[model samples]
Target: MRFALLATTMLAGSALLASCATKEAPVPVTPAAVVEAPAPAPEPAKPAPQLGAFGFDEAGMDKGVSPGDSFYNYANGTWAKNTPIPSDRSNYGMFTVLADLSQKRTQGILEEVKANPNSKIGVAYSTYLDTGTIESKGLAPIQPWLNQVKGLKSKAGYAALLAQADRNGVSIPFGSYVGQDDKNPEVYALNLSQSGLGMPDRDYYLSADAKQVANRAAYEKHLTNVLTLAGEPNAAARAKAILAYETEIARVHWTRVDSRDATKTYNKMTLAELTKKAPGFDFGGYFTGIGAKVDYVLVSQPSAVTGIAKLIRSTPIAVLKDQLLVRSLDRFSAVLPDAFDKENFSFYGTTLSGTPEQQARWKRATDWTAGALEDEVSKIYVAKYYPPETKAVMDEMIKNIIAAMGRRIDALEWMSPETKVKAHAKLAAFTPKIGYPDRWRDYSDLNIVSGDALGNVIRANNWAHEENVNHLGKPLQRWEWGMTPMEVNAYANFGMVEIVFPAAILQPPFFDPNADPAVNYGGIGAVIGHELSHHFDDQGAKYDASGTLTDWWTPADVAAFKARTDALVAQYDLYEPLPGMHVKGALTLGENVGDLAGLTVAYDAYRHSLGGKAAPVIGGYSGDQRFYLGWAQVWRRNFREPAMRQRILTDPHSPSEYRAAVVRNLDPWYAAFAPEAGQKLFLQPDQRVRIW
Candidate 1:
């Protein structure tokens, strides 16, 4: 969900901006009479590097000062030190600019609505923000619902209610009901993702490695403590309820590795087939509750669904309401967003060349574009904003990125030759989706009328739920894009073997040609590597080239990979940013792996580009050295306590400080940037995690 927002913003970046020029403005005529003006005909042909072009800089490693004093560290560190948190923003990062801008626009809208008390959007906002005070109905809906669920005296009845809640609470449209699928005999296999801690993915909770698991434990405790502050004053009773809720939900919160990519390949199953696999449960009602208007649903394993349904019918409701299940859903909805933002600020924000103003314009345009006016928006954007040169740069960047990925695959050591071949085949099969989608989502059915904020959210969510539910038993649309076209971030779906770069992130500090290659590599190129590496991350590694959730790793290699990943988890676990908050290395292992592997691949690519020739001055540091600095600078951020706490519980990536420190500590390339054998910069030796 954190990445979803990031992806949305990224997609919006490519949308058309509204025309700035007024129709009435007349073109100024050049003066024909001035003698001095005539002399201006021979204006000097000033030589400057073409926009988006970089000139080679020959700077060898420049390491005399401490790493804390490095240019990039100083620039970002200075900002981190001085920038105060704005009241409107919960967290601080480059995207803070976007949020600030959004707030300004939203405030303007709010003011307009306030002036016109009858406006739809105004009413929606008012209602959503009311906290139920308007009608003295604070959480009344929840109370009734809870009571209905609680009234189920029998275990069978209670189990049905719990299953309903699981469906209701699962944040993502596709992931609910996975544990009940008939395919996996291990009922809880899909349910492994739940834990009370507010973070993304189950790996964050279960991994016992040094870096992430340690953080996971601390994060869990800290979050529980925070919740205590928000819970009922009757500590013991509240604790009992919470524990009751947590473990119950965790039991049913199924895990689906790379769900985005794999969704399309799942076949559909009829209600009769589903019933046979898992009897006693009312299959028809469950489908109806899920709003499945269609006859069949896309099922990765019809067998699993049937099996899970059987388990639901047989298992006691108490067992279904396991603490892990409740916590998993709660965390998925609440915590994942903050975790992603904290880990890679630039990945979701200023990594691109565009300004916040430009991004805001893009987002508004894209949101509107997804409606009936999509063609109009696309045409306008292509004609007015999508420059030929920009397209060329994007095309070239994609080519280089894909090529670099091939090189990385060829260089893998632990992978068996057979697996490497398969990896290459997957890479070859990979699809590159850049900028906008070929098919825009069908938003025609959505009605934005009656702008009651609560109504609007409910309608939007209902529409989404209906859309997902309607997919039952239909052929998967391979061409369907998971993210909107104008989002601000990029991602790789390992199941699909596809990488997507939204229009939002293709600009600025991340991609302009004027910036040094070292910076670009550290910025966007490393990001490319990160996404590419996700195909091999702990979870992503579970999915094979066919986009199926099956193990492909050799037994020995899997063990070794886990060991290497475990070490990364340990390294990050020790980092403590606040009084009680700590990084959950297990939760962040995938990202941590991406950070390390991305940097490694990008650095290797950069070195290969130079043919191994040492460079002599980039701001007094070698090109190689500056490359790493540029990487660290991308993650520089600032945040307030509420925002920081929120992110700590939810996000999968480490904090910005750790994003830089943790990755660099494990990277030998960073040592070149701060080449002092015993310097603090070299916190860990290469031998520690020599794995690719």
Candidate 2:
């Protein structure tokens, strides 16, 4: 199963360049140096502010369009029209902008570190950039692993090979990971779920849409290319067999919506029970091969596991080995020869996502190094770029949001007093981790060879797997974070009962320190609220304040919550991003809840911050109007058609335009914009749905 975290779902981008200038040695004699006294050092140039005068980008707004008709366009129409998505990107916006800035900063850091021979990050990065070495090495580094697959004698021997694949970061029939046990949040547990599909989601395999059909064909061709490059005979036939095998797995896979349900998906069983439930597969051998010592495991999708295990038993041994080989080649394509990298990207990037070009090699190398040594890079990133004052401001904002949520909960008429008490307890218990983790992850034991790029990658994967396996039978590491400090995203981990904000997300449209109070509130302030509200959203509500999966809501509370959420789903289902593609309301319900509740509470918090005084108008716009605009501008994104279609099918968040339209559900928005009854986004007062 996926990690129990609700993220903002924003795409992260890369950054600019930095260089160090060397100063010539000063003259030994002062008299000789005085021959040309340097002009008074020029006053340092002031850095330009990221946004407009008060944080809102007024120039980006299209005032000709009424806020009611289309608030997103009214706020960001001009910017969207002028800002072309980068050729290497499928979509671009504020998140991408900030991500680019973060990556650029990271690039500078890597460059400095690369000069140090002992720096693991430097050695790893430099090795990845050595295209000549990579080309010369070819498949020599991974040949042993491929040969191991070829040496498999029977279906029973596949368990060990699959375990080795997991360590090397390759896809397998079943995916497993260590996580906080939902029912027992204090102890880590092993989780098993259905996997093996090459596409982003099961929909990609099952959907009969013309685009999906074309994607499947492209994927098959990509597979053939990879197999042929690996010197495998009958590559075309093997590719066809692999696709057929995956399609069978897809038929039994759980839908994203169903898999996300905390109550329905949690099925804990002993080793004996698992073997019995899925009799054909080698459960014991697989667990032992991975060195997992747990007596029991959490089965995310019980029926899917059974179905997949059966398929593993029924599929030909040759076909299974072929699938593993293709997956392995794709996984290490970056460190492999250029042909492997290009073919892998040709399908996954151009065909699946519509990105025209690959990101620069150095940028890709920087990303890989950061991911491989997340904390090492993050520790440096935080020290060089993140300031103490930013975290302090964010801390205060999170507290205010939590207080505002408390007030909202107290005022809820649908919730019973008993349930409200629990809600308050949960709110009070939320652990807001801002900027970075309290302690850094140690990577001293992980080896990084200077010239062996593939070897470094493989070792890093194995080290990470060992780290996760070591977590079993130990207490949860509360200081650990899922995101690095350089990532331009945030998440709410339900099991940990915490909301984490990385250092990189605290700039520009998200949370500029110099921006207006309203803008900050709508930007990061609302983001804080969004993550907090996730704990009370449809699926998250199943977990209690203790971070244990259980029913904490009363019967009446469930009914009322569902009634409101059902209306939200209906509202989103009507949104058509493409000609035939509409938002998956049921799949995206939780995020929609977060957007609605987050914005609503953020508005209340903004009003409260003013101490009941009327907000002053700025630049011919009221504070409420600016607040809404801030929310809209942050979601200003333009997506390529193919990418947009893929997101509609798989992503849990609604399209950016519809997400901005969430303002229509709030009563204050109606007062601020006075959207007429006939406008496209106008909602009747009673038609609005509010739940937090």
Candidate 3:
């Protein structure tokens, strides 16, 4: 499923930006039911702020820096300078801070249930933590899968094997999943897209840059390491052949920017049409293998699909089988012996992302358990850590942000009245889901054995695939959510016309109930506005209020929107995070729009919350100044050079520093700091691009 996330990071897993349209009416904005903690005794006075005296971290600021010249530095320069990205992490920021906290909390939850025989979470966690057992088993668990790959006798079996690999959660040349159709929001449809690259993007294989070239070499070495560990014959030669084969796959792959275009990617076709268009490979046998009984499928990146199919038919079966073997080995490396896990991390972590060390085994186990049994973990998470009062507070804040968006839409000068009406309708139709889902996913059928980590993961993957397949011929489950409650991220699902806030993201820096009103507005309030504005962003503008992908805008509206977004793209294009690499402005335009509009509306909401009364000065900073700082601090981050470079090519969000600099486009930000004419980020009033 495609999700317009608040931020994109490898830590959050791969969230391909796409839309999932839903037919359900807008659900009322309300807090989910929570297992409330025992009420605290009434206090005589209010509690202290969570972050600082007034919610902003004054010590983190650099007073020597001019806000206009470098607001991000002014707000977070001291913090960024002193703080180091964790040894096991590619980058560190507020998001990482919270994610670490969530991981610890999940670990605690697992500890409490590890002895419970009926708890799948317990069994999964304990089995993963059993290093001696894993070491003893060696490669025994995955030997059968390897044998299947080695047993491949002809090209005729390619489609079925690839489909089986996909179902078992192994990387393949192409992938398919069941999601709500873009055009038909009411029904679930099978979606296929190009896949198979071991690297983050096609650029890693195709780019001429020195860094990318080095990355390719490192990848091949890593492949050989895995192949040798798996006891393959002529490992080095096979690894080289596998890399050459994948480079061809990368050549046929679509660029990340083009793949993000909903209109271009959404190609509905009959089963026969798919077979005819990509005839070399057997599409029919593949669907049958996946257990997807659909009359038609939505092919994302049709050309890439066709190209990959042709490549599959032409590539040597031995090379293809070798690739599949390496993929399978690497996919389950963590559950394998220590050498395999460390080898996997050496390339993916140190070489690609520049992290010096791997995360602790227990932490990795906790994360895996939580992810494999997400809702089950979340059910306990929300009951313990999530405060019921926090959800209520978030609900009201979301409503305010939604109201703020409505005002912004009504005040748009470039949009025609016809377009404005639909914009308002869509805004009104937004379903804001706060904290957690109202309904929990049932994992009763999932079997997690105590001593079989590999088998458990495979079963869980198959179970998930079956769950997705079951969506076919059934009504859309409106209560379904894309993220678990323990995640530190939030998303705007355009197809559902809903904004989701996971329980874990609601904490210090993003949202603090004890913090000042302005800070909350600038932090989570802006986040809410960001998610809401996504429905009105460049691609999102194509979908109407009902979540149908259509052109509801007039020609003038479309042109006007593009004119502003094009300017945003150009503006971001000038930001050089690294010496030779610049931000991909077109690729990040949707998120940039979200930041610009979200911050603008959030400022408006903060002012409105004051009820026309002047905000009291705290720490000698005015209300607006504190608000802008709040927004900037939330994006405060430090990244390793390699991770920063990789994010430039693969991630949809701009660098955190650039994200914080989004304040340059706002008028209130200028008034708050009074940046001068010669300053770095001082955009002239007329030069500012504003679109809601």
Instruction: Give each model's whole-structure lDDT.
Output: 0.51, 0.90, 0.90
What is the per-residue lDDT of model 1 for residues 1-692, given as tens digits with 9 covering 90 to 100? Answer: 01122222222223333443768766665554433212223443434322222332222112333563343343365566566655333455654443344334444544445334554344434444443242343233234443564356665454345435544453311244322222221221122112232344343445454534554444444434433432324434433444333333334444432222233334545667656655756655655556544444445534444444555555555434433233332322111222322222221122211112223332332243232233323333434333446556656555666677678667777667777777776666767776666665655565544323223443555566556555544554556556543345778765466777765465554555566777677777788778877877887777667665676778887887888888888887876766667877776788888888877777777666666777547546677766776676566577655445545655777788777664444455555644455654455465456456
**Per-residue lDDT of candidate 2, residues 503-544 (tens digit):** 989888988876778988999888998999999999888888
lDDT score of residue 130 within candidate 1: 44
Provide TM-scores for the models. Answer: 0.62, 0.93, 0.93
**Residue ranges of candidate 1 with Cα displaced over 4 Å:** 1-65, 68-75, 98-284, 291-391, 579-582, 608-616, 641-650, 662-671, 683-688
Q: List the residue pairs that clash in candidate 2.
A: 13-99, 14-100, 15-100, 15-104
- lDDT of prediction 3: 0.90
**Best-performing candidate as measured by TM-score:** 3
Candidate 3 per-residue lDDT over residues 1-692, each given as its tens digit: 12233432322333344443677765554344433444544444557887889888988999899998899999998999999888899999999999999999999999988888777899899998998999999999999999998999999998899889988999988878899899988889999999989999999999999999999999999999999888877999999998998899899899989998999999999999998898789899999999998999999999989998888888899999999998998899999999999999999999999999999989999999988889999999999998888888888888888888888888889999988898889888999998899998889999899999999889989889898899999998999999998899999888899999999999989998889989989999999889988888888888888888988999998899899999999999999999989999999999999999889998998998899999999889899998998999899899999999999999999999899999988988888899999899998999988876
Score candidate 2 by TM-score against the native: 0.93
Report the lDDT of model 3 for residue 485: 89
Candidate 2 regions off by >4 Å?
A: 1-49
**How well does candidate 1 match the true structure in TM-score terms?**
0.62
